[model samples]
Target: MRRLPWALSLLLFSAAPAFAAEGLDGKTLGLAWAIPFLGMLLSIAVMPLVAGRFWHHNRGKVAAFWALLALIPIALGHGIGTASQAVVHTAFLEYIPFILLLLALFTVAGGIVIRGNLKGAPGLNTILLAIGAGLASIIGTTGAAMIMIRPVMRANDDRKRNVHVIVFFIFLVANAGGALTPLGDPPLFLGFLRGVDFFWPTVHLFWPAALIIGALLAGFYALDSHIYAKDGHKWLDPTPPREISISGGINFLLIPAIIGVILLSATVEWGEVTIHGTHVAVASLCRDAAFVAIVALSLFFTPATSRSENSFSWEPISEVAELFAGIFITIIPVLAMLQAGTEGAFAPLVALVQGPGGAPDNLAYFWITGGLSSFLDNAPTYLVFFELAGGDPQRLMTEGATTLAAISAGAVFMGANTYIGNAPNFMVYAIARDGGVKMPGFFGYMLWSSVILLPLFAVVSIVFFAG
Candidate 1:
């Protein structure tokens, strides 16, 4: 969800002016237009720390306030029709599908709980993390995290020092693991939607993803072993050792069904319908509808006991929805400026990625994309750089292979740099916290990533992007 606010905001603002007789050009728009978007980001970052109670209760209202600040000006400048159309375009074509997929995965995975009493030894913990990383590419980071997290938590329930376990889970399962496939992460899915081949990432990102995951797994093992030895392995096991079995098996079947619907949407172009002067793709509409149906099915068929066992609740998804609505609304102008390329207000950003000989710099692509994705939403950050590199999928896949790979690797891997770097990272954090893991505060988590993940990313950059 880290990228959702920034990505969604940029998209809605960019599209808002499209219906006007004379649309606002990014070249003509000034930096001041991006204030509301920045405000929304600041509110998200600072409010929770300064006014935790107020932020928790009124985050939706705060999101709405920032959104209105952006929209009111757009309506005035481009007329109400243009603003309305922009809202419709963003809602139908982007945000709805995005949220629905997350909802479906969360719901289905929540229903399937692993029943076990395994201890969380260093070797076992490493194996679980490895399994999760492998599953992430197949079922998505969100799905894999939802399915695996509770089991991991249950295994480590007796450990006095378990915060590092959850932190590394966020690093590996929730973010970096999703790099190898479109289904693995939202940014890659967006690339798929925009005409990048589905297997392109698989072909290009395998080694980079493997290297990072391997490094993290090794690092986590060393850290966990030290903590385990320091604690004298004297912690009482909460659940007596027993054979592991799975409950709510039906939901396992639903995971692939969700993936199928997404694939159907991408492969089958069923034409589109124009609503309020915005073209809505019928395939996307169908995909979203199917996701809703899947949600219903998961809730109906899976016994309430299973969900209860997983400690499933609606608060996380609800919070993401409310806050991201505002983000999507506020980011419209900033995305427009970036989309304007060299002619726009963000011309300096456009110029920064070019090399001395005027070609696109792969290292700059990796760092800039990763840096923004670390704080903002990686999906739109990937898009910004994708367009900066000329936005030709065919050319990017062929002649600019390294550049595309750099962008993809950066967007996916560096999202682990912070909890807000991706949607699953925060959800994993919230779940870990609720499950009694004293997860670090936002900055605390950043410190963990800074010490551990940053150096690994530097090595990756040198190996993959520096050439």
Candidate 2:
């Protein structure tokens, strides 16, 4: 298992020398090329459900199989050069920065343990969720989740009906809460990189975000109150009352450092270097390097006891890194098709978002972007729709503001619809399972989202996106 990443890395590096001059043309690629990508998605969705034990032990092998399925065919058909460039480009430009940020946030947030007993009453739980939602826009969903998850878990440690609590937490804190700022979510950050103003989402998405978040909060409160009343409102305090204190105070400083690194990558113009035909941005490279340092800093400075109290482990992040590596690789063709616009295989999909009169259908854009985002990675999904809506940030921000708003809202809000909808959703699920929260399996969880979120989204569509 440990050798799997190294082995895949070696395959990519060895193939790079063959493809130093050319790249695959998405314009000519057929729909069949996306088979491996679909295979990978199915494996993720079905493997754990049908063969939980087998998947648990060999998930890395499964991911590698699908990745190789794509790589081998791509290399054979397009020459090793194109395949290698794709691999290198995805690895250096996309996957590295992505996993590094997750690593840094997970490490730093895990290091800061809030120590005290707090009752998981309906009011307290709602307040904590609200705080986490607010903090998400400032520190990021991953950061807020890591910082808030354990404390929320501890607060409800003795409760019988707490799965819904964590589910709503994922809906609000890990996904929806990140709607306001670029710092809040990766999709918005990508939009920022593409020239969407930093506060554009704040101005445009505020009402939509407020509507969904407020509805979810009120719904959660109602459900929690019912559960509390049914359980006789039992007061269970294992530890004696004491004021809450935080350890690993230094990690609080690292949060801003993470934000700074991200901002630097966005604001700075550091030029680019061509690596085997792939253009690697210097600012991005520097950001990833700083993330490595941040991870080390948190690990070195944080007390071991702090992470232990938080129940932190590398398994969750490792799982994400491995799984998403395959996803990023396979998704290349799918993204390419989407990027190809009206000439590509996804032209029908592009057509769906347009009205009969040839105008952009705001409601269709909202649901289509969101529906795909629920299963696909939302960041890239956001990029796809952004391009589909005409990739001019200036136009999207002004005259096409409604279209942009719909894409933004869909990507951020509906990400909570599935565990794979966003990166943090699975991490939160893993952490909750580690804490013995008995979280639902993939489809089971979606059932919850369908019941709670789908109706609210319907309202959002009608109220905000309707013609």
Best model per TM-score: 1
Query: What tens-digit string does per-residue lDDT give for candidate 2 at 306-400?
Result: 88877777776777677777777777777777777778887788789988866899999999889988987787678778888877899999999
Q: Residue by residue across 1-467, what tens digits does model 1's lDDT show?
A: 44445435533553543444444567778888888888887787667668989998888778878888888898888777667776776677667777777778778878888888778999999999999999889878987898899889989999988999999999999988898888899888767766788889999999999899999999999999899999845778776777899877678888889878887887888999987676788998899899999999998899998888877777777776777677767766777777687788878887889888778889899999999889887776777688778778899999999999999999999988887788788888888898889999889999999999889989998999896
Clashes of each: 9, 1
Regions of model 1 farther than 4 Å from truth? 1-22, 230-232
Q: How close is candidate 1 to the true structure, as a TM-score?
A: 0.90
Candidate 1 Cα deviation (angstroms), residue 277:
2.5
Q: Residue 226 lDDT in model 2?
A: 95
- Model 2 poorest 10 in a row by lDDT: 7-16
Model 2 vs truth, CA RMSD: 2.9
Q: Estimated TM-score per prediction?
A: 0.90, 0.89
Please state every model's RMSD to the true fold in angstroms. 3.6, 2.9
Worst 10 residues of 1 by lDDT: 10-19
